[model samples]
Target: MKTNVYGDFACYYDLLGWSRFSKICAQRLKNFVRFRGKGDETILDLACGTGELEYRLRKTKLRFVGVDMSRRMLKQARGKNKGVKFIHGDMTSVRLKRRFNIVVSFFDSVNHLGSIAALCKMFKTARIHLREGGFFIFDMLSPEGLAGWELVEIRRKPGYTLIINGFYFPERTLAEITIEGFVNVSSGDSSGKTTYKHFLQKIYERSYPLDKVAESLTKAGFGNISVSSFDPDEPIENASRWFFVVS
Candidate 1:
């Protein structure tokens, strides 16, 4: 099995408060799907990190199938969710040979595709998996969003201490986040000494302007596109992230 970028970090994803955001996203997704869903809908989630969204929607009527490139992340997802199918694959090229009533990629996972060309390929992949008139809803970090994340912060918890540093290169439209930490992996021995494990990870994301994003979706053969802020109904301007609903 390939140890992807998420590797060790997968163990602490929810502990780091990342999963908390899934609650709001799940509700938004439920609302969007309920408006058009026929109560027996199937959803395809690309880059479905740790299946947090599924956990948030466990009571809903939709059936979810998740795909992610990180094997470690999928392991965490599979261990936590029941009856939901999880697959290992890259969103830019993976195919299931079946269509879904709705396709979603949340938490700016599309930004990891690295470039506009890769983003276009991901869009095409979503279209291929979507049934006719089905919607592809996703979100991306805006340039403003990336800029806001350019900071260094230290967090201390019960068993771990984490140092996070964020950097943004406007010239390259790239954002890099480095997470360095030590976790107390073992209880104290008779000598009252604890075992600590050190881990380091770097995550890279890229942002594009609205026009370029729309052009790529159009190139992917989508005729209808909706752009908004995180709310999915508010106008897009200076927000942390933007949502795209393309069909």
Candidate 2:
């Protein structure tokens, strides 16, 4: 079996305080689906970390499927949601023969792609699997969100020690986070500690602008492209995260 890089970290992933944000984002996504989705039974949650959104959406009438690259994250998601199918796969290249009425990637997950080409590839894949009138909804961090943010180190203890350090580059609209720490394990006579480090470099890509995203959608053969705040009812300028609803 392949070792999951985030498996050990998955146990304490929620301790980082992303659960609350995921809940809010999931609700927003659900609302969007309710209004614009074609009442299809299937929905895809791309980059569905730890299956939080999948678990929440299970209460609804729709059937949900989740895909993520982290095996550990999928493991946790499977434990929480046995009925919802969870697949360990890259978001950029998912090959599901069936199509979906709504495909959502939330919580700044799109930022992980790191480049315009990767982002365009993801859009292409979404277009490939989306139904005729289906919607692809995803969020990206705005450049405004990165402004004035400085590198900081923070430590959290929830079982093991986790040290999170972040640095932001305004010029590039990018932020890199380095998590370095130890996982404490108990043995018969003494305690043991193993060191681990993970790096996540995220690009805000806000410089692309909403018009550019629409153009990409058009290039991907999607029409009726719409960009708005996360609320869907709010103006685009007010949203820290851009929500693209493309058909």
Best by TM-score: 1
lDDT of 1 by residue, 1-247 (tens): 1123688888888777878878888988878876767766799999999999988888878899999998988988998898899999999999999999899999979888788998999999999999998999999988888886689999999888999998989987788888988888786667777887888878888898889999999999999998889865555777679987889
Our tally of clashes for model 1 stands at 0
Q: Output the TM-score of candidate 2.
A: 0.79
Q: Please, what are the lDDT tens digits per residue for candidate 2 over residues 1-247?
A: 1212455566556655555677887687767666766444578888888888877777777778898888878888899888789988888788888898888888777767766667788788788888777778787766655442445656555445555566677766666655655544444354454544443322232235566666777887887777767665656786666767777
What is the lDDT of every predicted structure here? 0.87, 0.69
* Cα error of candidate 1 at position 41, Å: 1.4
Model 1 lDDT, full chain set: 0.87
**Candidate 2 lDDT score at position 158:** 48
In candidate 2, position 209 carries an lDDT of 56
Off by over 4 Å in 1: 1-4, 188-192, 231-235
Candidate that scores best on lDDT:
1
Q: Which runs in model 2 stand beyond 4 Å of their true positions? A: 1-7, 37-40, 147-149, 153-162, 180-207, 231-235
Candidate 2 global lDDT: 0.69
